[model samples]
Target: MTRRVLPYRTPSENVISAEDWHLVTPDGDIAAPEALPDWDYRMNLRLRRVVNVDLDRARTESGLPADAPLLLSAVWTATGSNLSGPAQHLRLPRAGTVPMKIDFELSGTNLGGLLLLDTALVLAERRPDARPASPRRAGSILWSDRRALRLQGDAPQFPMAVIDFSLTSFPDNAAWHLQISGSLESATMGALLLLVNERNTVTATAFANAAKPRQIDRLVLSAVYADAARLMVEHALSHEDFSEESDYPDDSLGATMLILFDRLFPDQSITDMRLRQRQSPSLFASDLQAAVTIFEVS
Candidate 1:
C-alpha cells in the first residue's frame, strides 16, 4: 500500500483507529455495503462510526508541546452533485487516548454517484513556539482515513419528491412526472427531478418501500423506470449537441444523458438513432419501450 509522506514529523500508523461505518435503517443498523440499491432521492443517509486517537503519542512523536490543541474532523463529498461539506468536528484531548463517536446525516437530494467520507486528525491552532521539524500550522494534517459508499443503483439516479399533483397545474390523477430543466452543461443534480404524485398511492408506495419492494411494487417500479428512460432519451435526442464527439464535464447533465444513452442503446450510434427518432416518432417510442424492457423481471 502507498502511504502519503508529510513534510514534518507525524504520528505512527497506529495513532488512530477507526471502525467501519454503519448505515442506519428502519430495521436496524447494518454494516455499510459497497452499494445501496434501495437508496432514492427522497431518502436520507444516516451513518455512524467510532474513532480512537492517541493524542499523547501524536504530540510526543511530532515533537509538539504537551498542551498543543488537536482536532478530529469528518468531511463528506458527493460526486454526483459535485458538492461537499463538513460532517462533524471535535476537539481532542491534550493527553491520553480520545474516543469519539460520529453520527453523520446527509440529504439524498444533494448526493449522487459516490459518497466519500474523509476523517482527519489535524492541528487545531498554529503553535509558533513548536519544536524543530514539527507541524506548526493550523489545520496541519497529522493523520486521515477515507471511506466511500456507492449511491447509484439500477434505476436512473436523480433527485425526487412526492407531492400532491392537485396543488399545481398538473392533472390530479397523473401518477408521476419527470421535470428536466437547464442546459446540458448544467449540473445533473440541478437538471433532473422525479416528482411522484401522492394521490397515486401505487406509485408513491413503490418508491416508499423501494428498499424492500414486494412483487407488485417491483412491477410498478419497472413501469416507472421504463417511462422515465423514454423521457430522458427523448430529451437527449432533442438536443443537437448531444453527440458522440461532444464532451461534457464529468458531473454535467450531458454526461449523465450520454451514460443513459449508451446503457439503453449500446453499440448504437447517436446520429443513426437521432435520424430514426426524427423520421418516425412512434417507432422510436416502441424502440425505447423495448430497450427498457418494461414490466420484465431481472
Candidate 2:
C-alpha cells in the first residue's frame, strides 16, 4: 500500500516568527516594510540524524485556526541523479496566504533552482523577541534544527511566534514544473526519518532501499540574537570560504557546497543559530566585523 504524508504547516502555528517586522521595499521606497503578498520559498535539504520511523503509525498535517497558523512549510526527498535530469524538480506544498494577499511560490534548489529563487529576492530578517513560539501548546508536530530556526515578533520586545522547520536534502517532486500534482501529502515525523536514510541514492533497487539507515534526532532548541544585522554579519563571515573549489570538482559547484557543509558539521546536527561579530579593535575594522548570520540550508 502507498504511504500518506501530512500538512507540514498549520494555520495557528508559524515556521519562523519575527516579533518586530519592518517589511521593506527592494528599492527602499517605503520606510516601513509592509507584509509582502507575492513570495515563495523552497528548500533542497536532507535530514542528518534519525530518532525513529514508524510507517504503520503515520499521521498527516492540516490547516491552522485564526489564533495560530502555519506560516511556512517544505517537502523533502532525494533520488537517483542518474535517472533524473540535471537537478531535482520539487512539487510545492499547497500554499496559503494571510491578510488574504500574500501569495508564494517554492522551488527546490537542487542545482539551477537556487538561481531561480535568487531572481525573486526573498527577504528574511531575524527578530529576537522575549517569548518563545508555541505550536505544540496549540497542538502541532513542529520539528526543526536550531540552525534553521528563528523568531518573529510583534515589535522588538517579545516574540509573537517561533520557527520549527528546516529543509534537509530531499528529492524534488517531478510534477512541480507543470503544476500537475493532484494534492500535497502531509508527511509525518516517521516518514521524515525514512527520507533522512534514503540519502537520495538514485540507482538502488527496492531491496537496496530497505538496507539504508536513518540518521536524525528531535530536540527542542532555545536560542537568541541581538538583531537581524548582527545575524547577517555572521552569515557573511561564515560564507567567506563558500567559493573554495579546491576540494570539489570544477563542474560541481552546488553539490560541492552541500558536501562542504556536511563536512564542516561532523556532528550532523544544527541547533541554536547565532551571528558572531568580528573580533574587537583592529581586526574588526571595516565591514569584516559587521557580517550577517552565517547560515545556508539550500
Candidate 3:
C-alpha cells in the first residue's frame, strides 16, 4: 500500500490572542523595524530593508467584517547565495490591526544574496462565547515529535473560521515581470532557483525553440526567467510540497528549476545546485515566506 501524506492544518482558534504569533529575526530576536522596503540599490554594498504600507487605509479599503480578526503574513526568501538566515512568522493583534513595522536584518558587507519578499493578509472569525486559549492549553493533548503514542486529553473549546490567502497570486491570473538591471564591475558567482508552471513552461519552451542557440546573453536570460517564473507560479500553487519533512532539491522547486536550466545550458553542468524552502517549524502552516534557494557554480 502506498503511504499517504497528511495535509498540514493551520491553527485557527483564538488566532487573535496575544503570543499566538510574533515577528522575529533568524536569531529569535523580536523584530520591531518599520517595514521591509522593496528592492533597494541605494544602499550599495550594505543590506537594505524597507516597506511603505498604510495599514489604516488598507483595512478601510478591505471592507471586511468589523469583527473579523486581521492577520498579516510576511515572507522573505534568499536567492543566489545560501546564507542560512531567512525568517517567517505571522502577526495578530489583540485588538485593532497588526503592527506595520516589519523587521528584516541583512547586516554585513560584500553580500551577494538575492532576497524576495511576499506579504498578504488573513481574516479569521472567532466564536465570541469561547474564551481565547493558548496553543498549548491545559488538558490539551498532542502527538509527540515521534508521531506515535497518542496522549489523550480535552480539545480546546475555542473554535474559529479560518481563511487562506494564496501568496504569489495576483489579480486576473496575470503574469508579472519585475526586473532591474545595473552595471557593476565584479567577478561574483551565485546560483539561481526558479518556480515554473504549465503556462510558463509552454511559453518558455516556445520561445526557446524559436530562438537561435547562440543568441545573446540578454535573450538567454529572458528565456530562462520566463521558464523559471512559470515554475515558481506552479510551485506556489502546490504550497503543500514545501511542508514536506525533507526540503531537498529533488522534492522542492529545485527539481523543476534543473529541468529548465538544462534547456538554457544543455552542455554546462550546473554545480553546487540547491532548492530550499525558507520557513520556520516543521508543522507551521502559513505561507509567510516564499520558497527560495541559493547556491553557487564553478
Candidate 4:
C-alpha cells in the first residue's frame, strides 16, 4: 500500500497514477525464496498511463542484485470500459543485468478509456544455506492482492479457497526492485491453467484472421477485440477460481465498423440509428480504412 518514487528510471511522458506496490526479499536460498517468503521490504511509485496516439509503452527501471532470478507483474485495468486487463508478467534470468522492458497496449481508439496499473516485482537468489524443498507450482499467481482486479459476475464461485499474494520493494546498491510472491491450491491452479489456455485460443484466432485478411480495418478490429479478450482473461484469473465468464465482443468485424463510424464522425451520436441507417456500404469502407491510422504501430 506504500508508494515511493525512486531516483532512477522515471517516465518522461505524463504519468496518470501508480500504486499497490510490494517488495520481497531472499531470506535464504536465492534460487528458492519460496521457503521464507517474508522478511518485510516495501515501497511505491506514483505512476499510471493514459491512452495516446504515441507508440511507446510507459517505461520505468531500477537496479537489482546484478544477476538474480526475478518475477514481476502489473495489474492493468481499463475502468470506464469495464475491462480488467491481465497482469503483465516477466521472469528474469540471473545473467540479465540490463534494463528490461514492460509494455501495455491500448485497445480501442477511445482515449476516454482510463488505465490503472499496479506492479509487484521479486528477485530470489540461491543461497548456500538454503533449505531444499519441492519447487513451488510454476503457474501460481504471484501478486497476492485479489481485491485490485475484482469485477461483477453472475457465475457460480469455485469449490475451494483461492491463492493469496504478498508484495513489497527492497533496495540494494541504492536501487530498488518490487517483489511479489503468492501460491494457489491445487484446484485453483488447475482453474488458472484452463483459463489461460482459453485465452490463448482466443488470441491465436484473432492473430490468424488479422494476417489473412490483409486489410487495415480487419487488423484494427481484431487487435482491439483481442485486447478486450485479454483484459477479460486477466480479470478472470485475478480471482481465486476460474468461474468468471469474459464478456468481450465476439464480433471483431462488426465492432471495427462501429469504432470507425464513431471516429469518422465524432460529432454524431450513437443514439441516432437514423444516421447509421443512411451511411452506405461505400462510405463505411472509406471510413474503416481511415480509422486504421490510429492503430498503426509506427
TM-score of every candidate relative to the true structure: 0.79, 0.15, 0.23, 0.23
Measured by lDDT, the strongest candidate is 1
Q: Pick the candidate with the highest TM-score.
A: 1
Can you write out model 4's per-residue Cα lDDT over 250-290, one digit (the tens) per residue? 22222222333344446654434233334554563344344
- Over 156-204, each residue of candidate 1 has an lDDT whose tens digit, in order, gives 7788889999997889999999999998888787788899999999999
Ranking by TM-score: 1, 4, 3, 2
Q: Which stretches of candidate 3 lie over 4 Å from their true place?
A: 1-57, 81-86, 94-99, 104-113, 124-298
lDDT of each: 0.87, 0.23, 0.30, 0.31
Give the lDDT of residue 167 in candidate 4: 24
Per-model tally of clashing residue pairs: 0, 60, 13, 21
Clash pairs, candidate 1, are none
How accurate locally is residue 275 in candidate 4, as Cα lDDT from 0 to 100? 36
Q: What are the per-residue Cα lDDT tens digits for candidate 2 across 125-181?
A: 222321233223322343321121111111111111111113332234211010111
Q: Lowest-scoring 10 consecutive residues by lDDT in candidate 1?
A: 35-44
Candidate 3 minimal-lDDT segment of 10 residues: 142-151
Which window of 10 residues has the lowest lDDT sum in candidate 4?
35-44
Q: Candidate 4's error at 58, in angstroms? A: 22
Candidate 3, TM-score vs. the true structure?
0.23
